[model samples]
Target: MRKKRRYIIVMATCILCFFGIIYFIVPKILFYTQMYDNRINVAIKNATDIHDLLEEAIHCIEKRQYYSAIKLYQKVVQDYPYHKKTEGAQHAIGSCYEWAGNYKKAKEAYNIFMKKYPDSKLAEICRQHVVELDNPIYRKVNDAMVDKPEQLDKIIKKCQKIVNNSSGQKKTDAMLKMGECYFLKKEYLMAIEIYQEIISNYPDYSRIREVEQMIGVCQGLLGNYGKR
Candidate 1:
C-alpha cells in the first residue's frame, strides 16, 4: 500500500509539470506569432492607404484642381502625421495655396514648414518663396527710382547700400535697381557696368534676361550698338 501511494504522487507531479510547460511556453510562442502577423498586416494596410492618397493627390494637382489636391494632402498630413509623407504633404499644401493664387496663405504655410523642418530639403525652396514675397520695399524703391528721376543719384546710393548689406535675392534685386537708377540718370556707362557685374556674379538671379536687355540698351545709348 505505501509503494502504491508514492507511485501515484510521482505521476501526479509529472503530469502537473507537463501541463505547466505546455501552458506557458506554447502559448507564449503562439502569442508572439500572432502579434507579428498583426503588425505586418497593419503596416501593409497603412502603406497601401498612403500610396492611394498620394496618387490621388498628385492626379488632382496634375489636373490643376488645386483645391481638391490640397484637401487630399491635408488628409494625408492629418492621418499620417508621423509618416514620411507628412513633410511632402506640408510642402504640397503650400504649393496648392500658391497655385490658387492665395499668396498670403501660401506664405503662412511655407513659414510653418520652415519653422518645423528647418533642415529639410524643402526649407531652401520655402526660403526662396519667402524672399520673393517679402521684397515689397525693394519693389517700392525701384518704382520710386523710375517715377522720380530727379532723385536718381540718391536712389542709386540707397540701393547700393542695400546691395552691400543684404544677401541672396534681396542683394540681387538691389543691384539691378541700382543699375536702373543709373540708367534713369543717363549714366549709361555706369549702368552697363552694374548690369555686367550682375550677369557675371549673380547668374542664378531671376532678372538675368532683363539685365542683358538693359546692358544692350546702355551700349546703344553710349554709341556702342555695334558691340551689342
Candidate 2:
C-alpha cells in the first residue's frame, strides 16, 4: 500500500509539473497554479491516503489561503505521522510559508523537513531550498521594505533590479511588487501605469484580476486627489 501510494504521489507530481508553470513549483503548489484542472482534482480525490487534509490543503493553496493551507498540511503531518504522504505534507508546510512571504518560517520548516527525512528523496531538494533562503538578496528587498516602509523609493529600486534581471513569471512578480510599492507610496498614477504595463505584457498572470482591481483603486484615488 505504501509503495502504491508513493507511486501515485510521484506520478501526480510529474503530471502537475509538466502541465503547470514549470519554472517554480515549490514556491507555489504545483497543481494549484494551473487553474485547477478537473483531472488534477480527480487524481487528488482518488489518492485515498491523501483524502481530506492534503486535498483540502491544496485547495487552500490554490485560493492563496496560505495560513489555512499551512494548518491543513501541519495536520496531515501531526495526525498521520506514518502516512505515505507525510513527507510531502512536511515539505508543503514550507512551501506555504514561502508563498505567504514568510521566508524565515519557510527556511525553518525546510530545515525541519531535512532533519526528519534525511534519507528521503526530498532531502536534497530541501538542502537546495535552505541554500536559496539563506541568500540575503532573495529576501532583503522585502525584508527591508517591511522594516522601513517609508523608504518606498529604495524598495521600488530594489524591485526594479529584480524585474530587470528576471523574466517570465519572476519578472511579473517583481513588477507586481514594484507596483505595490508605488501604491503604498500614494503614487497613484505611477501605480496605475505599472499595473497597466503588467496587464499589457503579462496577460496570463495568475493574479490578473487582483492587478486589475489595484489599477481601478489607483484610478479612483487619483481622481480624488485631482490628478486624473
Best-fitting candidate, measured by TM-score?
2
Clashes of 1: 0
Flag regions of model 2 displaced more than 4 Å. 1-49, 140-228
As a whole number from 0 to 100, the lDDT of residue 148 in candidate 2 is 59
Q: Rate the local accuracy (lDDT) of all candidates.
A: 0.72, 0.71
Top lDDT: which candidate number? 1
Q: Give every collision pair in model 2.
A: none
In model 1, pairs of residues that clash are none
lDDT by residue for model 1 (1-228), tens: 999999999999999999998999999998976775464444434556765666556555444556666767777787888887678678778867765656678899899988978987667777776676567864455446545667788877877899889899889878877886776677778888899999899987775755775675466456564244
Clashes of 2: 0
Worst 10 residues of 1 by lDDT: 36-45
The TM-scores of all predictions, comma-separated, are 0.40, 0.42
lDDT of 2 by residue, 1-228 (tens): 999999999999998888675557644765555544444445444545545656566556545567777877776787789987687678878867866779889989989998999987667666766776788875676455544567778778877998989898778877988887776666777888999999998988765655765665466444432122
